[model samples]
Target: MTLDPEDSKLITLARAARARNGSAEGAAVRDETGRTYSATDVTLSSLTLSAVQVAVAMAVSSGARSLEAAALVSEGDPGSADEEVARELGAGALLVAGPDGTPRS
Candidate 1:
């Protein structure tokens, strides 16, 4: 079955995987009023693993990062709730930039 593009469980796994091996890349959160906020603490990179990795890279590039306490989930679980999983992981929603630098999710 095809997975929902917005699935958070898959996103989390992908992010974790990137952290483990993928090289950390910087993401551009925004550029307005000569000010910007970025998620520099966490590592973000796309090593050609899966769609999830691409999504995650976009999120981080959009300035999303893990909170003090965050819940992590896998797509293998039932009733996979996107927001719920993020809340459990103490993580906030992430925004990833598309090829054109447009924010995704």
Candidate 2:
């Protein structure tokens, strides 16, 4: 399937985060204001957070009250929590892309 340019940009950011941190997953989200936030999986011994969760948290902490879209780039699929959080933030799109940055159906 084809991806919107904005969504593609999210995938690019997510992919870069994954590569930069050598994490298993990376995620990016766009807020209602069109601002974007990106994060990688946090796997510290005392803390474990999905990339999606971290990205959402970043947006919220940055004063984003709602989100427009989200993208996850990983070998694995996004967990239910990822979808739930996006939904709660009013995200219209929760895109999942492969590690190679290919959108999943």
Candidate 3:
């Protein structure tokens, strides 16, 4: 599938985050207001959060009421938590990409 330029940019950001952190996943989200947030998965022994979840939280904390789009780059599929958060925040779509930034499902 062909992704829009914005979508491709998000994928690139996510891929960079993942590579920088050496994490299992990385994600980027665009808020309705055009602001963007990115994060890598947190895998602490006491707590764990997916990259998508962290990105969503960042948006929320920054006072964004809704999300326009979300992108996740990972070896595995983005989990249900990612989908649920995106849906709850009214994201337009969830874009899944591989570690190499290739669009997946």
Candidate 4:
């Protein structure tokens, strides 16, 4: 499937975040206002959060009321939590991409 330029950019950002942190996943979301947020998975001894979850939290904390699109670049598929957050923010679909930045599902 062909992705919009902005969506492709989000995938790039997500891939970079994963590379930088050497994490299991990376995610990026574009808000309705055109702002973008990116994050890598958070795996701590006491807590764990997926990259998509963290990205959504960042957008919400930054006062973004809605999201236009979201991308997850990871080896594994995004879980229900990721989809739920994106849906809550009004994102119609969650773009899933591989570690190499190829859009998968």
Q: Pick by TM-score: which candidate is best?
A: 4
lDDT (Cα, tens digit) per residue for candidate 2, span 1-105: 988899899999999999999999999999999999999999889999999999999999999999999999999978989999999999965899999999994
Q: Give the clashing residue pairs of candidate 2, or none.
A: none
TM-score for all models, in order of appearance: 0.22, 0.96, 0.96, 0.97
lDDT of 2 at 10: 95
Model 2 per-residue lDDT at 54: 99
Which is the better candidate, 1 or 4, if ranked by TM-score? 4
List model 3 lDDT by residue over 1-105, tens digit each. 999898899999999899999999999999999999999999889999999999999999999999999999999987888999988989856899999888986
Models, CA RMSD each: 12.1, 0.8, 0.8, 0.7
| Superior candidate under lDDT, 2 versus 3 | 2
Pairs that collide, model 1: 58-96, 59-95, 59-96, 69-90, 70-89, 70-90, 71-88, 71-89, 71-90
Task: Quote the RMSD, in angstroms, for model 1.
Answer: 12.1
Candidate 1 TM-score versus the reference: 0.22
In model 3, what are the clashing residue pairs, if there are any? none
- Candidate 1: Cα lDDT at 94: 37
Q: Rank by lDDT, descending?
A: 4, 2, 3, 1
lDDT of 2: 0.94
Clashes of 2: 0
